[model samples]
Target: MNPELLIAFLASTAGAATPLIMASMGELVTERSGVLNLGIEGMMLVGAVVGFAVTLGTGQITLGLLAAMLAGLGMALIFAFLVLTLQTNQVATGLALTLFGIGLSAFLGRGLVGQTVDPLPHLHFPLLSDIPFVGPLLFRFDSMVYASLLLVAAIAWMLARSRLGLMIRAVGESPDSAHAIGFHVIGLRYGTVMFGGAMAGLGGAYLSLALTPMWVEGMTAGRGWIALAQVVFATWKPRGVMLGAYLFGGVTVLQFHGQGFGLAVPSEFLSMLPYLATIVVLVIICRNPQTILLNKPMSLGQNFRAD
Candidate 1:
């Protein structure tokens, strides 16, 4: 590949990875809090629809983004109420949430289909955008790309260095112990879940409003599932989630780029690379049950009871 093309490819890969990174990182927090929110895809779909609809109507991308985040938060609250308060099974509730998000987005976006919104503008640093190789790769990107990186850094710090992070870790490990110590387990779980939902929503908005600039049914195409797998692949680490997402993104882009370069691989087989990679990584990471148990949240997917 030409140097410029390679740089461009890397840049596009980063751009593609942004949404996955955001969603996976958010999920990292949710799972860290001992709540396995499988409804990430649903939250993302709702955000995409709401973001596009609002942006089309109001012509304000920021509002659209906020609206998407709020919608995601609402969904998270519902999930929290069902799983945390009512003690519903996390897996079932999460699956229902995904179904609900898909149906709602399809219905709500019906009238808005085929409409377009102004894509989020790209940001160019003064001197940085001019550098030969790094310039095109690092300096030229939309605002969402930068924001995604910041989120990764912030999340890593919060998880590693903050008191709240400790509380979250405590709750995930043993809500009973946390509750015994007055950590307000339920409240902490709710907060973290909402934050995760908001991040997932933002990821969806990045896809619909910024990256693609259009509405399409089920456009996320299992990226949410990939994000869930990434949390496990990373052993619940935020930095690992970022790296995993980019790796998957690179695989995804490689398929298309390969096609562009006249690779003889069948398109169907190429399309399966991301999901296949996910499964292979999972098998490797989870090969040892003891190791997985050591890293996994003790209470993950379990219903917590106050009694």
Candidate 2:
């Protein structure tokens, strides 16, 4: 590959991976706190529609991003209430949330279809973007891309070193013991789950406002599922999530560019490549149960009631 083309491909790969990094990191934290909220796809869809609609109506990208996060947070609150307060099944509520988000976003975005807004602007440093190759690869990207990287770093630090991190880990490992030992298990779980939802919404906002800048029903296109798989593939490690997201992001970009490179494969097959890679990764990971058991939260997906 030409050096210039290779640089562009890498840049595109980073852009493609940004949303997954943010969303999966959020889920990683949520699961660490022992809550399995599987409604990421729904959250992303609702966020995309809400973000696009708000941006279109007000012409303010900031407002659009805020609205997207709020929308996702609201959906997560619903999930938290059902699973935590009402003691409903976590898996069922999460699946229902995804269905609800799909329908609601579709309805909300009906009129906004085909409309386009300004995509998120790339941050160009003065001398940095002027540099030969390093500038384009590292210095020129939307703020969110850098933000996602920082988010990953922050989460990793918090989970590994902070007192709060230890508390969260304790809660996830043994909620009953955590509850007995002066921890507000329900409260912490609610906080983590809500955070996850906001991140998912933010990821969706990145899709509509940055990646494509338009509202399409289900634009998320199962990236949410891929994000979930990322959490598992990373074995619940924050740094691992970052790497897994980039790996998938690279695959996604490759699929789009494969035909142009004369791979001679059907476009449909190319489109399916990202998903196929996801299944393959999941299958390989599942084959090694020990890897999962080592880091997975013990109380994940369980309903907790305050005694």
Candidate 3:
């Protein structure tokens, strides 16, 4: 393969994977806190639309990103209230949240279709970016890519070594025990769910503000679900999440450039490559029940009532 082609492939792969890294990391923490929020797709859609609309109107990317996070935060709050406060079924509520996000975003973005905005600028280092191969590969990405990686490192370290991480893991493992031991299980779960929503929103915002710089209804194209799958693919580990995201990202980028590489595969099959790869990886992972069982959060998707 040509060096230039390899550089482009690697760069695009990192771009494609950035959103998954953000959203999956958020969901990773949420699941670790024993709450299952399936509204990520919905949240991403809302974030995408809101971010685009706001950026288009106000000409401020930062505000748009912040608004997107708040929008997602609001959605998570609703979910938290229903499942945590009212003790509603986690799965049902999550499904409802997704549906609501879809409908709400569609309504909000109705007048904003066919619009586009300037993409987030990629950071350029003066001398380093002028370097031959390493420059384009390492220094040309936007800030979000590096931020996502940093978030992963932070979460991994926290989970492995922080007191707060211990509480979150405890809540996921046994809410009753966590509650009995004087930890506020409900409060902690609320925080994690909200954090997940914000991250999902930020991921969505990235789609509009940086990746494609445009809005389309359901623009996320099931990436939210893929992010959820990635959490499991990584066995709930942050570093593993990064690896899984990049793997999926690589597959996604490949489909776009597959024909360019002289592959004779059908375009339709090429389009299906990312999703198909997801299913295949999931099936292979599920075949080993112990892999899931050992790392699975005990109280995930379960509602807890305080005694």
lDDT of each candidate versus the true structure: 0.90, 0.92, 0.92
The window of 10 residues in a row where model 1 has the poorest summed lDDT is 1-10
At residue 204, give the lDDT of candidate 2. Answer: 96
Ranking according to lDDT, highest score first: 3, 2, 1
**Model 3 worst lDDT window (10 residues):** 254-263
Candidate 1 versus the native: TM-score? 0.97
RMSD (CA, angstroms), candidate 2: 1.0
lDDT (tens digit, per residue) of candidate 1 on 69-184 = 99889899999999999989999999999999999989998998788899999898999999989888888899899999999999989988999989999999999999999999
- TM-score of each candidate? 0.97, 0.98, 0.98
Off by over 4 Å in 3: none
The regions of model 2 sitting more than 4 angstroms off are none
* Colliding pairs, model 2: none
Alpha carbon deviation, residue 95, candidate 3 (Å): 1.1
**Tens digits of lDDT, candidate 3, 1-307:** 7788889989999999999999999999999999999999999999889989999999999989999999889899999999999999988998999999999999999998888999999999999988999999899999999999999999998887999999999999999999989999999999999999999999999999999998889889999999999999999999989999999999888887887677898888877888998899999999999997777899999889997
Model 3, position 129: C-alpha lDDT score? 89
